[model samples]
Target: MATCCFLSSSILRHPSHTTPLQGRLQTRRNFSFFKITAIFWGPKKTTTPTTRSMMDVSLGTFTLIGSPEQKPPVEPKELQQVSISVVSSISNVSSIDWDACAVDANGQGIFNPFLSHAFLSCLEESGCAVQETGWLPQHIIAQDENKNTIGVVPLYLKSHSYGEYVFDHSWADAYYRFGYQYYPKLQSCVPFTPVTGQRILVRDAWYKDQVIDMLISALKDLALKLQVSSLHVTFPTETECQRMKKDGFLQRTGMQYHWKNRNYKNFDDFLMDIKQSKRKNIRQERKKISAQNLTMKRLRGYEIKDKHWDSFYRFYRNTTDSKWGQRYLTRDFFHNMGSKMGDNVLLIVAEEDDKLIAGALNLIGGDTLFGRLWGCLPQAYYPSLHFEACYYQAIEAAIELNLSKVEAGAQGEHKVQRGYMPVATYSCHYIVDEQFRNIISDFLVHETKQMEVVMKMMQDSGPFKDGLE
Candidate 1:
């Protein structure tokens, strides 16, 4: 599960591995779901899957953590003799095959760089998201009869729910109060990243739908077999959320602010579409960068050198080390991603007297510019640097690149006024026990309605001109 929504001083940064509400979890007699103290982290235990039963499906017999109560519906005959296994490392799969699945799974043209082989592999290789960090990779890989790698999921046997943007601390606390184990649960997400994309990845094929169904079954069965309290597929596409809900998973909804691009020639042309007040405020914020004598530069791929990576890592750590912050990504991750992801990496840095003072890290998606991380020299505070580096630069980059939107990472009401209005985000959960499942499901029902109200309010209060979407 993701941490809480409380945005700290270092606003406009990546969303995961945050200082959750657990630190100050409030309590009162006979409290509700939001009251319980979060048991965020604990002793790291093994989540290695053991063969408990063999599931008989058209694809083939596959190992499972728990046996199904009923047989799965018929799989398409085209997916004959399919094999699914939980691998411990991303290195076990070739980037060529893994990336192919990640790219193809996006029925839309959007590509999530966080789901790419390079990104996940760098997390493991850099020693940031390993078992010691409570993010043990148990990625699933599926193969068809032809031995073609067709599907993959970036799953983790997590001991804590720190970095996931979907908060389930209350559920864990409930499990604790009821004398149940909750840690070592299965979490499907991009580590230290909250940008939503496809979690159940399948290559484009005639049996794509069947493969997706099978993968869903595999995840549920794996959760049961592992004997974890639940399985969480966080930040999936809304369509995937619906599909999972139809298959017995509990649906959930939350909101994040994202700036959508309307057809515009430039940043000024786009600003005219927003309300005059918000537009004036945005222009003033941009002006602060100049008043501070800071030059903002957007560097992509090879344009970002080792020196920039060095400084950017410091910037990222500065952001994470702020109040209630925890550094999730290691310094090496920056260098590794720089070498591996090439042009997909967007590093916007603030320079003063030719010295790098601050930076914001973003990934260029197929149709979006993702604002992931940001920071500056911790000792000095520049007015509006965070907003300029993370928000304005991202919006400018998205427009310049002709991308569809700019996802300014997690929660921030401030972003709405700056053009990143609320957009609904989704996740699905599967509880092994029916009773507990219903309890959480009931809570989700109420929570989803609240989200709908909040999203509508944000939409109605958007900075855009009345005629804009």
Candidate 2:
């Protein structure tokens, strides 16, 4: 997520928001027992400290609120009756049912690792994104009269807007200026993740549309019920963004650079498609690794050992601590998530003289390689090391996996020159006060226009010979 980068507007940076995010979506799988049993990974469970990460996403229970049977804003007669409920943790819902909605939401087969039950639970259980950290889970769910879970929204009762890439501290401050309390606004996202996907996840069913609309209504209803200032859905799909905007959410846009795969056989094949100058620059940049006497390695799944996680933590802190910011993730998060996610985790490290100097972490999606976190040994600056580790290596891995794209997190004009072109990321905000909503809506209209111009300009100047396809 380029966790240290100051994304969005002034609200994006000030008030200590100057960081990236954790994509906040959720899913689950079947399990043999209840109470979050320790589910070991790999052929054998290596000895490690007992942590929440070992608790597998299998079967689970949920707390449901009593909502009288009602027809939804969108009428699908097939759905007899449905109710929406809120829970404090993803653990309350079965991973299989939660993940079902997460998967079917896209209507495409692409799997978002950040949206998975395994990923979201790691953030919560690791204590990285919790009430103490200002991210309290108030996840919304939809179910039919028969108690079948059909939809889910990963949400947080936010005390501040730090983890969400769609910064709104200015909005918060405006509320303060008006003597309003905005500290407890609602956030719908994967805590600390900025990657784009669905936020209102509804399972593929005859009643899908009704479930989606009802889920949204539930989100707003809960916000109003709690008297929160607003509700925000960050990094949602364009379709979801538009739907929410039409339903009165203020649409906001931001830019991110992503690299696409054209079925390239290899990295060189990918380079050949870009402008010659860009291609030459990339080749030269990649060459710097050998010149620096550094060893580059991309370890996946079981290949990543405890020592690698240990080094990556130091590297991550080296970046986070630079902003005088407290770290969002604990060291235990890496081990717990790594052990659970396995091959889905890609740890790219740079070693010099047998010492780990730097590392970049990526999560494998169905078709996209997510460039998540990257950092190096404090005070160790190697030429082009950041690009090689975070961008080029990500592109290479994407190509190798036959993936469609490489999302290089947030904020870097340099990424454009290296063939990562800008794309619009969408978010929508629902302000409760009509007056404030009108004001922010006007602002969003202008910001969206400006964002379009920036995106068009970036597209025109892309490193690709034919521009973005």
- Candidate 1 deviant stretches above 4 angstroms: 1-79
Please provide, for model 1 over 234-316, each residue's C-alpha lDDT reduced to its tens digit, 9 standing for 90 to 100.
Answer: 99999999999998999877777788998667899889998999889989988988998999999998999999999988877
Weakest ten-residue segment in model 2 by summed lDDT: 25-34
Q: Candidate 2 regions off by >4 Å? A: 1-79
TM-score, prediction 1:
0.85
TM-score of each: 0.85, 0.83
- In candidate 1 the C-alpha lDDT for residue 118 amounts to 95
Clashes of each: 6, 18
Query: Over the stretch 320-427, how does candidate 2's per-residue lDDT look in tens digits?
Result: 999638688999899999998999999999999999999999999998999999999989889999999999889888988989999997777788888787888999
Q: Tell me the lDDT of candidate 2.
A: 0.77
Q: Point to the candidate with the largest lDDT.
A: 1
